[model samples]
Target: MWRAGLPGGLRAVFEGSPLSSGGSPRLLEGKVALVTAGTDGIGLGVAEALGVAGAQVFLSSRRAHNVQRAVETLRGRGLQVSGVTCHVGRAEDREKMVQAALDTFGAIDILVSNAAVNPHFGPILEADESTWDKVFRVNVTAAAMLVRLVVPHMEKRGGGAIVLMSSIAGYQPMRGLGPYGVSKAALLGLVGALSPELRRSRVRVNGVAPGLVRSRFSAALWEDEAVREQALKELGADRLGAPAEVAQAVLFLVSPLASFVAGQTLVVAGGAWSRL
Candidate 1:
């Protein structure tokens, strides 16, 4: 028997009781995420974060061994994960990567274009043609092409998130970085140009610019004591950044929590440059 009023004339209606215990909705449950060059470093970090958040993450790198190793490592952690060998600079490899994700996860809800190359470390003017081409091709062009391929699938799902990995060097070129910095600068522009068009299709495009992240890729910069000290002085952070920190920012950008965020580059450089 239920009463129509409670206590002193206040109406009380009890049609059905609410459930006392229910699982909180994960931000990315059942979602599919694809991350390029994800076998190690920041790419792998992003992949792990997405997988932990309940997304089936697909990762890839140039070497088959690395792909297998990463897949096994993530699987051992009980994350829904898979991988394949892919060189982002090659068209066939890129196609194969996309197909692999489709085959395993059905659809891609998040894309992290994190593959980049910095073959040369010298003045921009002295950079060889081959070095410039390689840097631009992998760092800038491949990212744009991957976005082109993934956007169609994202549209099919109504909307999705895309994160382009840039660098603090994009805003303030680091000494001796030359063409690599230029390529990163182009990524910032790429996000700006594509964000509006991507938004029309309900797909959000954003960028993450990290500064002096400690990884095998940037070992030359941070591993040297003198160089590390100078960088630290400029950055004002006593510690260099870890890949996980960058990965967290990428997770936020692609999550429902950042639904209103789009067409912007979030700098995860630990206060290296004010503009970045």
Candidate 2:
């Protein structure tokens, strides 16, 4: 989900997924986490963060190889972790991933919905119907559906946390990535819409909106010298945000560190002008 070149025949993400292995935090010691789009970039960082904090982590990607690599990397770090190939956009795959997490870890305590797609990068109106649908399917709809599946398990555990990934584009609306921005905007709304109700179950729902981060998936945004320079002017010469920086914000939200926080999207945009 964090890779580039979306839509049609790059990587088969939605097929029935096969489960895979190995595996936290010292805050999430007995907790279990399920993270989608977690093979690389921000997703991977979040998985690692939660694991280090003492949670058994569950990671997923559309690609089997990605899942294998991620599982190996985390296990190498001595974290309790497992993985499965999943297309978050696919209901069957989502179900399998959740079951795998439960079957492997006993119960669920944290959920991170990071799957997203940006098939079209142009004026919003110019984007085709399919483009909009694909964007919403993976970016917005899948996350909500995941909430539905995991919240019940969370309630059983007495309480849990859900962290939906958003982006700076969600607020600022990137020039050409209109469809993506809008879909992310919906996540911000999802946070607001779902939080109050989730609180009834002792579950806190929050969001993280990262700015441009250095990752293969986003290399297109700031890899160029001119664009990099412009980005630096806005975010400071230190360079674009890193996936781990964003992960820290997510860790804060999922941990007891933010027990009183819910329904709010934490912006980890460095210095970017992001707000709605």
- Best-performing candidate as measured by lDDT: 1
lDDT of 1 by residue, 145-250 (tens): 9999999999999999999999988888688898998899999999999999999889999999998888889998898999998877876656677786688789
Write down the lDDT of every candidate, Cα atoms only. 0.84, 0.84
lDDT of 2 by residue, 1-276 (tens): 222222333223411211111222267678999999998899998888788778899999999999999999889877788999999889999999999989999899999999888888668899999999889999999999999999999999999999999988888867678899999999999999999998999999999998888877777778897877775575443457777667768888999989999999998877777757
Model 2, position 269, has a per-residue lDDT of: 79
Query: What lDDT score is found at residue 81 in candidate 2?
Result: 87
lDDT of 2 at 86: 93
Q: Return the clash pairs for model 1, or none.
A: none
Error of 2 at 224 (Å): 1.2
Best by TM-score: 1
TM-score of 1: 0.89
Candidate 2 segments whose C-alpha is farther than 4 A from its true place: 1-25, 231-238
